[model samples]
Target chain A: MFLPVSASLRQFARAVTADRLAGDELAGAITAENIRAGKPPAAAKADLFREFILKWREILDANSRPRPFSSAEYVRSLGPPPSEARLVLLLNDICGLSQRDIEYVLDPLSKPFAELLKEGRAVIARQREERKALIVEDEPLIAADLKDVLENMGVTVVGLARTADQGAREALKSAPDIVLADYNLDGQKTGVDAVIAFQDSHQCPVIFITGYPDDVLKGEDVEPDFVIVKPYRPEAVQAAVAHCLDTERFFAIDADSANGDL
Target chain B: MSNEKSSAPEKRVEKLQIMVADSELAMIDDWRFENRAASRSAAIRSLIYLGLELTKSDPDAAAKLLDQLDRA
Candidate 1:
C-alpha cells in the first residue's frame, strides 16, 4: 500500500545506489540501509514492498524449468521478470508510498517478513502474561476505572482497599500479583506505606500514581516500578501495568507462590 | 468475523502455541514421517487450542470432550 513519505527517506535511497540495483528500479537493500541509519515509519514500510518483490523473484527462479512446461507445470509456473521489470511491477502494484518514505525507511531493504512476524508473535506472548496486582488508591471511581482497564486486558484485580491498613491486610491475605496504589490515601496512610507493608508479606510489583509530579515524589518514601503522574492516559497505565507484570528478573519469590510467572 | 464463527462448532480448529526442545521437535518429525502423514506441527498446535477450548466448559463435559478427541 502507498504510504506518505518524508524527504529523509529519498536521501537514504540515493545513498545505497552503489549496489547492483537496477537503474530502472529501486532496490530492497535501500530499505535495509535506511533502517541502519534509523529510518522513519514510511521508509520502513517501503522496505516491505521491496521485500515482497524479492520473494516473488526468488519463487519464480525456484519454479523455472528449461523446457516448455507441460500442463502439470502450469500450477508451478510464474512468469519471471528480469531485475528491472520486477522492481517496476512491484512499485506499480504497491504504489501510494511516497518517494521519500520509500527512500529513507524502506529503501529496498528492511527486516525480513519472518523476523517482523516473529516480533509480532513475541508481542502477543508478552501481552498474555498473568499478574497479581494491588490497587492502592482511596478514590472509588478512579480505582474502579483502573480495575476495568486491567480486566479488559485479562488481568484479575484481586482486592480493593481504601486505607493503608486495609490495603496491607488484603495484600497480605490475598497476596495480589501487583499493587497499584494512590500516592495519597484517606486518614493516615499513603500509597507508599501500603506498598512497603504489602511487600513484607508478598513479592508483587507496586506502581504509584499521584497528582503531583517529580518535584515531590523524588523525596517521598517509595518503592515502585514507576510513579505515574496523574491526569493519566489509559494507554500509559495499561503499558505500565504490562511492563510491571513482564518484569520477571526480580520477584524470585517462587513462580507459583502468589501469581504464576509469565 | 462471521465466517470465523461458522466453522464446525463441535470441533472448531484454532491456533495453539507450543515450544519444545530441538530433540523433541526431531522426535515429532520422525513420528510424523513414519506415519506417512504431513507435518504434525499444525495438528499438534490445533489440538492444543482445541483442548483448551474444550476445557473452558464444565468439568464433566470437558473431560468427556477431551476423551472423545483423544486429547485427555
Candidate 2:
C-alpha cells in the first residue's frame, strides 16, 4: 500500500540535491534571512527548497493521493492484455511514470504471467499426493537415482523396470500417474517403445529421458508429456515429473499439432 | 583501520551554482511552504525533476527517462 509516485518524487529530489543542484545565491540569501530571523543558518536552504516546490506544485498535487494504487487495480484498468507499447504509454500518461519505472513496477505484477505461474505451481503442489511414478531405465544406478529424485519431490515411485516388457507389465499392474523412461533400454527395446506399448492401457503422462531425443522421439506415433536430455539435473527431473503429473494428456509438442495429440 | 577505510572506493561528487532573481526566490519560498516540503533543497530538487518529467515526449520516452534517472 505504499505511495509509489510520492516515494519516487521524494527519491528524485534526494538524488537531484546530491548531484546537480544549483541556485547558490538563493540558498545564501535564505541562510542570511534565517540568521536575521534568529533561526539557525545551518538550515538556510529553505528558500531554495521552496522555489523547487513552487515550480512543480501541479505535479506534487497530482501525485499526493490519499490511497496508493494496487496491482489488482492496475490490472483492472488495462482490462485485457494490451500490446507492450500501449501498456507503456498508459503507465506513462495515466500513472505518470517513465518506461523504465513502468517496467520495474508492472513486470512482476503482470496479470497473465503472474497468474499463470501461480496457478501452475499451486496445481502441481496440490496434486502431489495423487501422483505415482514408474522409472524405466536399463541402467540400475540411473534408475535408482531417478527413483530417489522422484520420491524426494513427493512422487511415489511404484517400480523400476530395465526393459520395455518389464515397464509395460509394471505400469499395468501399478497404474502409475506418470512414467520416467530412458531412451535406450535392455532387450533392444527403446523407452519410446515402452511408452507406446502401455500408453493406451495406462493413459498416464510419460517423460522421456534421452541423449538423442531428436533421433528417437521425432518419428514416434505419440510424443511424451515432457523430455529431459542427458545428463539430467535433479531439479529438472523433479520439475518435469511435477508438470507431467499435473497436466492430463500432455505431449511435449503443441496441442494444435495433430500428430502430438494421439 | 585507516587502510580498510582507504580501500573503499571514493564516490565522485561535484558542486554546482546558479543565479535567480529575488522575485523568483520569493515564489519558490511560497511554493515550498504551501506544499509542506521537508526542506528548501528538497523543494528545489523536486521542481527540477518535475520540470524534466513534463518535457518527456511520450510514455515510452518518459519511461526511458525514468530508467536514466534510476541509473543516475
Q: How many backbone clashes does candidate 1 have?
A: 30
Model 1 chain B: lowest-lDDT 10 consecutive positions = B1-10
lDDT per residue (tens digit) for residues A1-262 in model 2:
1113322222223222211122122233343455567865333132333433333332324443322122122112211222233333323332244444554534544445434344433433443655688999999999999988877777788899989988999999999878899977767788878888887676676777777644532313465545566777775576556544432222223333211211
Regions of candidate 2 where Cα sits further than 4 Å from its true position: A1-127, A216-219, A250-262, B1-72
Model 1 residue A16 distance off true place after TM-score fit, in angstroms: 34
Displacement of the residue A227 alpha carbon in candidate 2, Å = 0.9
lDDT of 2: 0.51
For A129-248, candidate 1 gives per-residue lDDT tens digits of 355666877899999998887776667888888889889999998877778888888788787777777675576666667775433322123445544557666644664565455432
* Candidate 1 regions with alpha-carbon error over 4 angstroms: A1-130, A215-221, A251-261, B1-72
TM-score of each: 0.40, 0.40
lDDT (Cα, tens digit) per residue for candidate 2, span B1-72: 111222322222212245888998888878877765434554665577665656664667777777998999
- Every model's DockQ: 0.01, 0.01
The 10-residue segment with the lowest total lDDT in model 1 chain A: A15-24
